[model samples]
Target: MRFCILGLVEVQDERSGLRVLPTGAKQRALLAALVVKAGHEISARRLIDELWGGHPPANAANALQIHVARLRRLLSGPAERDADQPERRPWIETTGHGYALRLSPAETDAARFQHLTDQGRRALLHDPGQAGELLGQALSLWRGPALQGSVLGDICADEATRLDEHRLAALEMRYDAYLRTGRHGEITGELVDLTLQHPTRERFYDLLMVALYRCGRQAEALAVYERARTRMRHELGVEPGPALRELMRRILHHDPALARTPGPRPADPSQPRATPAPADDAALSLGDEMARLHRRIERLQREQDQLLRCFRELTASAAQRDMSVNWEGS
Candidate 1:
């Protein structure tokens, strides 16, 4: 069985696929708190405090015990049975005054990700190339938002924030690697997405503009700066920082300094730019074509409206003539 905490909390038994925890919110909270603090024993009192936020009920301890029992049963259920032991087993083990999930540090994706990132950072001083690969590997562990569908209290919220910071650092480290290797074009789209997602992150915007300029898309690079400037003015009532302003100046002056510096001698010959996925390229192109089609449809509807108006006028005139002739005969 493996517990994944890099994103949402999930437990998977190789034999039985994925296991869904019982439905109670507090019950799930109890499990998530333990999972985040995995490998360490959490005191029963602390668990109660976390669940109830200090003003726990008189029966809070009893309630916690009940929740723990339920979680233990779920973990030890038939789905998690091991061949070595015919008896069902509980993954959570009890300490003198606390409980710990019986999981090796390696069994959790979150732990492994953090470990790899730490190693990468240390390796960076000696071998940036190897550090970049390790950081990239660490980043691939995240599937989505951490603890999705789970409500986080004060402590869990802090843990989530710390985890996110680590992920971002790993991403920046990877970007640095790409930059070092002169893979400027490859980082452009990613930097664009990152800047959009984290609009206030000035560094992302700077990196994006640099990447764009390096790829010889000077016009597009200037446009990106303009967009970032507009966004900052409107959203935050501020201007771009010194670093971004300097980048813009360099770009406008066509500074040779803006060009990608060749890496240490014996640089690999530049490879052809990889084609973007067909689905993504098609979606972008289809968006423009769809807009044109909509405009054409609107124009046709207007022409149809004019034809209908003229037909109505002709029908009224003919009806009036018939009525006038009938009146004259009478």
Candidate 2:
């Protein structure tokens, strides 16, 4: 049998590809914990603690034994059992004070994912091209949220959070590889969505601005900075950090620094200056100022229109009242 734990927890038969394990909540939790901590022996007492969180029933040990027995029976097929004691067989091995799921490292998807991620990271440090492919392989192992159909308590919740962060790190590494290969334009949409989902991650915002600038959308890159700056100030009551501010400065000055190295760097303390001819710099600055003024004008125009509408309604009501009074006088 094989265990799938990159997403939902499931146990499948190797030959028939059928899920032989029970789908009960407790059973699924038990399987999830085992998969996350694979190749290690988890004590029954620890299992009970995880399942019940220190409020176990009086017969908790007996209940756990029954559950383990059920899981073993489901995993053990008829071909492996003797006719004399078919119902009392054990598939989970008994250790000194715990039970261990007997499976090879290759039988678990979580294990495979971690292996591929490690290989990918190593490859990234050596060859970015090969690293992208390895990272892609690692990402493909995730079917959805880790342990998606299982009941997650404290331990499982922490494991799930760690797995999610690992996945994000892998994605960032893959995007780095893409940027190294000059595929920034192709990744702009994905980076945009990521920024929307995680608005506070400065690295994603930096990548997005770089992608936009590289794609010859300098104006859009500036807009991205404005948005990120606004979000940071509104949500966190602070301006963009040094790294993001440096990126914005580069964009504003049209500095060659925008296309420098692929890795992250600390913000240079010196102020950036426009490198183009004086006439060109003047034109770019004029255009930027015009855009800013146009935005302010639009906002004022909207407010003026609302005020005019209200005034016209009040004037019509006053006119109607005067006509009624004149009719009554006649």
Candidate 3:
């Protein structure tokens, strides 16, 4: 059987693909809590608390037992066991203190998604192309917000937050891989949307700037940085981080290192691949010298603006003095 919690809570029989979801809200909540933390035994009191929040019914324990029994029967199927048929093991086992729901890693999409994202991240530094593929697969599993169907108790809410965090991390990693592989032109639009959605995240701004700069949209890249700075200052009362500032400096000077490199050729799956040479920090640190230069440029520009204003004032004052002198002579 496979359980889905990415969107609605659903349990599908592996053989028939039939959905066997509990009808009642409390039953569904109980199931959701167990499924999210599947493989661990949840105490009876904890399950009761999740189902009823602060106030539980006088017969809450009895009600929980009834729900557990119904779920067990549904999972076991309706076929009558005969003398010839082997004894069926229970899916929901009764523990000493509470109940535990046993499910394989493949049975739940959330677990599978986590597994794939972890694997993808591990391979990210060495095999970014493969990492992108795996992370993409992990993201595709989510149809909407996690556990959209059931009311979220504390446990369910925590699980949802954890899954969402993983989802965002995977997306960021995939985009980083895409940028590294010279797909800047393609990712710029999506990065624009991501920046709008998560303006506080400096990494998204950095990636967007890089993509725009690489695509010959240098002015737009600078504009993005300005927007980020404004948003950050207005919202968080802080400036953009160092990496993003460094990237801005690079774009200002038209750094050739910002130009995209030809991505590595796709390796054959059957062949044992040689290790790639350690990559240079050119893409990352090429702007170290430029950072100081950019700071100086900004200081000079400010000074120039002050000088120009002083010059204009002095010229106006001299004209007035000449007019006064001519009138006095007359």
Q: Backbone collision count in every prediction? A: 0, 0, 0
lDDT of 1 by residue, 1-330 (tens): 667766667676767675554566677677777887877899988888777885788998788888899888877764346666544256777889988876666777788899999988887655667778999889898987766545446646667788888888788777766766667877898999998898877777777877776776666676677778779988999988998888877866667766754345454469563321222344435434544564696699799999999999999999999999999999
- Per-model TM-score, in order, reads 0.68, 0.71, 0.73
Cα displacement (Å) at residue 18, model 3: 2.6
Candidate 1, RMSD to the unseen true structure = 14.2
Please write out the lDDT profile of model 2 over residues 192-269, one tens digit for every residue. Answer: 999899887788888888877777677677778778877887889987899998887777777786665353333356
Which regions of candidate 1 fall more than 4 Å away from where they truly are?
A: 14-22, 54-58, 78-90, 119-132, 233-239, 268-330
Q: lDDT for every model?
A: 0.74, 0.75, 0.78
Better TM-score candidate (1, 3): 3
Residue-level lDDT tens digits of model 3 in 1-330: 677888878777656557777777776777788887788999999988888888889998898898899878866762223123334346688999899887666679998898999988987777777888998999999988887757647888888888878788888988988876667878989999999999999989988887877766666777788789889989999988889888887777766677754345675699875332222355335344445655797799799999999999999999999999999999
Better of 2 and 3 by lDDT: 3
Task: For model 1, state the Cα shift of residue 217 in Å.
Answer: 1.8
The candidate 1 region of ten consecutive residues with least summed lDDT is: 273-282
RMSD of each: 14.2, 10.8, 10.8
Record all residue pairs in model 1 with backbone atoms less than 3 Å apart, i.e. clashing: none
Tell me model 1's lDDT, rounded to 2 decimals: 0.74
TM-score of 3: 0.73
Model 3: worst 10 consecutive residues (lDDT sum): 78-87
Scored against the true structure, residue 191 in model 1 reaches a CA lDDT of: 93
Error of 3 at 16 (Å): 2.8
Segments in model 2 whose C-alpha atoms lie over 4 Å from true places: 12-16, 19-21, 78-91, 104-106, 234-238, 260-287, 290-330
